[model samples]
Target chain A: MSTERGLFDLTCADFGLIRGITESWDHLLSRSIAAVREQFIEQCGLIAQAEALPRIAGRILGLMVFDGKDYSFSEIAEELQISRGSVSSSVSLLTAMGVIERTAKPGDRQDYFRLSEDPYTTFFARARNRAERAHKTIQETRDAVPKDKREIRSRLKEYETFYATLIKALDSGT
Target chain B: MSTERGLFDLTCADFGLIRGITESWDHLLSRSIAAVREQFIEQCGLIAQAEALPRIAGRILGLMVFDGKDYSFSEIAEELQISRGSVSSSVSLLTAMGVIERTAKPGDRQDYFRLSEDPYTTFFARARNRAERAHKTIQETRDAVPKDKREIRSRLKEYETFYATLIKALDSGT
Candidate 1:
């Protein structure tokens, strides 16, 4: 037998993650994978390494991709062992961003939800739309702000222009 | 007058940023900036949008640069309005990474600290050291683990090799 432990083979009993994961009713490694995966997709700029917000957000998104079936609000909250309020808010945000679909399930009063199969495209669409608006606003500021007092606006304009042009080129070429 | 907020004219508020330098300390925008800036410097790879972390870390470092003199733990904490524990930890991490120096002032029991110049070089040294160890560990695992069971190790080896070489080159450079 090897002296080292397999990444997933080790139990919560062997580590604090297991203790927390089990108590939280989650698989720690699985969650870590999800969190890491989210960062790869969004690179939203690093935040506190102490708390993995990406993984927290990822788990919520991953859970929505539940087995071919749409889930209700209560069912999701129960499964994730999280508050209904949290699920509601996260779901609302995801829905507004078009990465999750929400509708009434047969014989259910609560909204039913499912992950968007093309979450990458949908998510990017939402992000791109926001980026475009920001770019426009920044450009507007650049034009209207007095020349002597527009350093920040100039910086914002540079960023918006770079990203806007880059994404457009990507869309056209891809 | 154009309908856009002009330069940093001592008093313009950003939608997400505190407009005036004298904006109320109690405002959410100001608090958000303080928090974001804090996370930014401590954790690298942050972009400008990291309006909080990078900004906070930069400001703290900047403040230390301005003083160019040792500050008691309490003094720095009070200036930033953060708790002593946080100051202690941030300072400790900075010291370990060689970003700051710690010492006891003459005839004073309390330890005082100041930012160490050329923190960029020191920061990369710490990071490069970490990357080397992680790469070596992963390379060892790839060599030992069963072929059918070592896909993660294998992929890690490829990536680690690429990064290790890159970091090594950077270290040897300049």
Candidate 2:
């Protein structure tokens, strides 16, 4: 009976500690702002998944881009409620993609990350590259066709024109 | 021994029939054209998957777009070597998305599918709609932020402007 009482008391103390931590976090970041941030981050994650990228990478991007501030590596893991390992790999991926960049504060040894300058331009340039590749594929297909197949050649030409126009539009817009 | 011999003859006869069918198909559609069409269709399927659309639907679109002609439901299934049910469902999906359309010949009882007259325009319009949605999401997020958080609001406004510019570019190009 004494041991059972002691266990119950310990559970109560742990619950109180958890509540205290949550309350402090809520005080630092308002509940409304947290909710908004979560929604925005989820949306960006969905967008990234649609592009065949990792959802966590997109969420990391959302955090930095929406906050418009650099976050230390540990802070990112803690604030996003994700594993440090996940944060590390995703940061590397975003860095390699040129979507985000890493920096350091003068006295701080920990790495910091922020959205890259002109990420939208980089994204559009990637689109242009994909369009160019498609254009080249279509052109090669056209070349492989015999000269006698006029109908097929003409159709392939039309596809080439379409991709060329799309590339030009991306170029001008970017 | 006679039974084994009979099976061997049947196998040879089947092989000859298969070769003959292949030769006729090659005559009707040259081997080179077939190879090019397959590559183009596969590429379209990849693009469709990237956009979160059904890959088979994209292949159907590629066939019609590349050939610049309508295909009957049965023809679509046979040419793409997919099941009839898959073709039917994907056709419905593409029709709903306004990426492809169905038509009927004067004497034909079957459904024929073709690329919409302005499919690229439709595609761009869909992109603009997505941009608009992202913009709205950002705006709502911004509204939820407290007035004291000026920095977050400013960053969200920048995102809104980026999406707005994108929408405008898509509008003008389309």
Which is the leading candidate under DockQ?
A: 2
Clashes of each: 15, 0
Which residue segments of model 1 deviate by more than 4 Å? A1-58, A65-69, A103-110, A117-174, B1-59, B65-86, B97-112, B117-174
Each prediction's DockQ against the real complex: 0.04, 0.24
Give the poorly placed runs of model 2, Cα more than 4 Å off. A1-31, A106-108, B1-31
Q: What TM value does chain B of candidate 1 have?
A: 0.56
lDDT of 2 by residue, B51-87 (tens): 6678998788888877878899999999999999999
Error of 1 at B21 (Å): 16
C-alpha local distance difference test of each model: 0.51, 0.80
lDDT of 2 by residue, A1-174 (tens): 354664346676788998999987765456667777888899888777765678999789889877888899999999889999999999999898888899999999999999887666666666677778878877877776788879878877876887787777676676
TM-score, per-candidate, Cα-based: 0.38, 0.76
- Among these predicted structures, which one has the highest lDDT? 2
